[model samples]
Target: MTHTTHTTRTTGHVAAPRPDVYRALLDPAAIPRWRVPAGMSCRVHTFEPHEGGAFRVSLTYDDPASTSGKSTARTDTYHGRFTRLVPDGEVVEEMEFETEDPAFQGLMTITTTLTDAPGGGTDVSVLHTGLPEAVAPADNETGMRMALDNLARLLEHPG
Candidate 1:
């Protein structure tokens, strides 16, 4: 199996938001609020949020083609667990994504680091490893940025 690695960084000013990275990533109820692109929704079918705990997220898009005219549908399913969690700073999750599209099938491990910035903001960095060499790194970079941007927006509007 060919291996590839990609890294992405996203920084935003979050005013007095929670400083805990585990809280931001592991909370099932808060996942749909920020774990995907804007307009897409995430549902955590099972989440334990600790080392060796089970984690699964069903991502549903709002497009007709994605949902096949259904009101809600799953576009992608992620099954994995938190390999490591460092309280409010770092989390390492090993995940495998299953999709209807064959091109997207792969095992990936994402190491997320959240650092307290100068102005009470969080500098979020994600290092993704074990991607298939056939997959373009740019695609991973763009997707990570979009997800982080969505997360920033969600933190801004908690309702």
Candidate 2:
């Protein structure tokens, strides 16, 4: 089993916000808002924000006729157990994606850490492990960056 790993980090200017606000990231309702670019949409089939809960989301480009909207760009149907939830500070999720696609079929764990900065902002770091060699490092890096960017935007403007 070839193993690969990826790590990404992002820092926001605003204070670390509330733990509850960070926790909102796991919610299905809030996922679509930040899972992708503003024009894309996300649909969650199951999202239980707790230890051993399962989560799945389908990210679809809004314009079906557009080149980007040929099909669901990605359907993350994965099972994960929240190994640890440190309120606003950190979340460690152990997950495995079920896929026949050679590029992304493997067991993976993602640990997301949030630290409070001096200006009440938060610094987020994500460490991904157990990726298959078939998956490119750049792709993971780009995806994580987009996801974190989305999270930052969501926290900045709460509904």
Pairs in clash, predicted candidate 2: 14-121, 15-120, 15-121, 16-120
Residue 1's lDDT in candidate 1: 46
- Estimated TM-score for each candidate: 0.78, 0.76
Worst 10 residues of 1 by lDDT: 65-74
Residue-wise C-alpha lDDT for candidate 1, range 49-84, written one tens digit per residue = 888998888777767466521123536677888899
Local distance difference test, per candidate? Answer: 0.69, 0.64
Per-residue lDDT tens digits of candidate 2, residues 29-64? 887776664455677777887766777656555565
**True-structure lDDT of candidate 1:** 0.69
Q: Which candidate is the best by TM-score?
A: 1
Residue 155 lDDT in candidate 1: 74
Candidate 2: segments with Cα more than 4 A from true spot: 1-20, 37-40, 61-76
For model 1, the stretches where C-alpha displacement exceeds 4 angstroms are 1-13, 17-21, 66-74, 99-103
